[model samples]
Target: MMAPDVARVESAIEQAARRGDFDNLPGAGKPLDLPAAHDPDWWINQRLASGEIDSQALLPVVVLLRKEFERREETLAALPDERAVREYAEDFTQRVHQDRRANPFQRMLAPAWDPEDAVARWREVREPRPAPTAAPTPEPVAESRRRRWWPLRRRG
Candidate 1:
């Protein structure tokens, strides 16, 4: 009951298998976890998960810039000193400046990050945290701790 095209394709696959065309290929033995529905980024995500591509290398310039912006505070925290944080922030913002798109349509793929604002935000993240202060003591409750119970109602 198989369609002619399906039968033809099956015959072709059998022939290829006999010729060892599918042997020794990468991930040949491993089963792929394909989704039931179509996914545009599935391959890219798989490549990242399999270590075939680095996160930074796989990410687009615009995406990378956005990721940098999102991780700005964490990056600053990881730096040994404020100067290092400032340098990183400056470089990140500069790169973002280089990739900015002027056209409104094209701008969707290349986001603009203001270098000055990035630097300022970095400075804020790098500032020393204030010393912890004791929390104010709670005031005692003023309501009476009375318990009330309803007596069984007399048969109406």
Candidate 2:
């Protein structure tokens, strides 16, 4: 037997469906199949699979999954086995490697260009140098070595 609130929600959903309110609604929170663009391992293996994502291109996808996980983390943690998480992570890694290999130029160019070195070189080129100024004149030492002030003096 369903709870009364659940039954009421079901009825409302059914009514909404009948009235075309839910007819063309897309799966708003569903993960994109993303076999090629987002899940390159799936693209490489030619089998679409649900998994973790760690690619820069798939950052948005990861963010969405993270939000979902955060929302349902307790439920996920309560599951008997966490093997699925491992499997998913492996699948994501494979996809990312496959995607990385697809674009040889990007892989080659990324490491070839060093932004940090370029910035350092630019600073070296544009650094300001101190202006030429007259040498500092040293004060003359007193010829006599007499004490400037007596050790003790009484005021009159």
Best by lDDT: 1
What value does the lDDT take at residue 148 in candidate 1? Answer: 46
Clashes of each: 0, 2
Candidate 2, after superposition: displacement of residue 76 in Å? 44
Candidate 1 lDDT by residue in tens digits, 1-156: 999999999999999999999999988999988767899888877778889787787556777778777776787667776566557766776676666643234454534445456556667877888999999999876568644476666797
What 10-residue stretch in candidate 1 is worst by lDDT? Answer: 101-110
User: What's the TM-score of each model vs. the native?
Assistant: 0.46, 0.23
Q: Tell me the tens digit of each residue's lDDT in model 2 across 46-153.
A: 331323333444444434444443443343343343354444434544544454566545422112213344334334444576899999999877769656675677
TM-score of 1: 0.46
- Pairs in clash, predicted candidate 1: none
Worst 10 residues of 2 by lDDT: 107-116
Off by over 4 Å in 1: 1-49, 81-83, 101-104, 109-123, 144-156
